[model samples]
Target: MKRKRTISLNSSSITTRSKTRAAAAAAAAKFYLPDDCWESVFKFVINDKSKFKNRRYLNSLSLVSKQFLSITNSLNLSLTIYNGSRPFLRRLFQRFTNLTSLDLTWYDRDLNKLLCQISRFPLNLTTLTSLTCSRVDSLRSGDMCLIADCFPNLQLLDLSYCSYVSEEGILQVLRRCCKLRHLNLANCSKIELHGMNFEVPNLEVLNLSRTSVDDETLYMISQSCRGLLQLLLRSCYVTERGVNYVIENCTQLREINLRGCCKVHASFVASMLLSRPSLREIIVPSLRHFSVTEREFFKRHICLVY
Candidate 1:
């Protein structure tokens, strides 16, 4: 009986020591790592290339601890709202205070109401750099002015397929948004540009595809936006002369889309391709005019997209 009791006491002492060690380890894990270190780790993990993986990892991390949840919320800078309501917009602004980019391309609602909500709220959106409201047909000149007022620090604005926004609205944007770099007015057929000496010096990428942008407008673009890198003039009214002028003046131009631009002939394109070594890609409608050797030569220097 004595021997058995001694053995039982020894087993109890071992069990108690094991439980104490485990409790100490749990405490260490809970308090050892600093918040900044954890923030860096979370940032690295959340910035994974695959969106699906990043979201999954973020969701799982948020459930790990309160610190993780706060970090996740603070680091989320980009947001895309498809069906945004006033209440929802308010909630989003409240939740993510550091939003730098917003995409409402898929938002199927009246922009006036949205703008009203923005105007009503004293939201700190100075950090916003990119805004895409593509296909929002109801956006008028007044709406563009409102956007300029709200997002003064905007660098990239995509108003593609918003046919209702005319030259008045576009000019308003160009005048106000001086920091604008990339502007996409693709398929805005009604934008009428006469003899206006507008200049967007910082403007780099412009898409006037399928618009009635003629040589005069092209000349204005060449003069104003000299630093233009990529220009898309597909299906535009610009002729070979305009194309040549742009090529000669806009020395920084790398890629130009001339697809469906029926007036832009092959000879001008070939001459520009030979003259401008800076030209990287020229997307045309056809390559039938070029001989096999000529085609090979052109291909070696630049990308000939059909």
Candidate 2:
């Protein structure tokens, strides 16, 4: 009743007549939209981190189609490395080639070797703009030099609370990072009391709080960093004379923190408020009282008196 059903007996065929009435079965594969759609989705996810943490979200997306993975990798511009993430640094660097900011605040490991590895990569000047290595116990002068050599174009560097860093280390940063706008050396007390003198014209915000920053260093800073917007000398041993030099030189200073300077007097601070119209905020020493005139003057000028 049925016509003859013939099958080819080609040896090259994966399935032959010997395997009768049988074939492999598979599920439907997932599909993806065009490149533009993937790009939009990647951007949305990268910006909306409420659903997934940054690295984890990216890692999950990378398991998708190749196009989606590529889009995610391209959209990732920042990375926060952990102490245990040292082994994967190379891979992370290779993937997030567009990183402009790196936060190493939590990483307390062998920073010298880590920096050496980062320097080897072909990262552009614009590849990294902001870097934070604050509170690093093992930071050294060589490490600071490595930072200058690796990311010379860094605009914001936070080296505050580091256990040890010599004047030479801080000096290297000021010299090599020509574009440095903000530098935090708070509590890096190991810096020499006299030798840290270098020019950083572009430096806008400098924190020398709780260090051995003497009047000479302060004067040198005033001369060098004239465009300073925020100068933090909290708990430093600087005097009214040194502070006077800063107020006179740094014409663009919007905020100054002089809290805890034993040598600075409130009368001098009152004079600063009266003289410097550009000041938006002033943090005077504790236990010092401001006169009614000083208070009224600061209020009149819209300057924050603390």
Per-candidate Cα lDDT values, in order, are 0.82, 0.81
Write model 2 residue lDDT over 31-75, tens digit each, in one string: 536777877767775786453376678788889778768777877
The C-alpha RMSD in Å for every predicted model, in order, reads 4.4, 6.1
lDDT of 1: 0.82
For lDDT, the strongest prediction is: 1
What are the clashing pairs of model 1?
none
Q: What's the TM-score of every candidate structure? A: 0.84, 0.79
| Angstrom error at residue 229, model 2 | 0.2
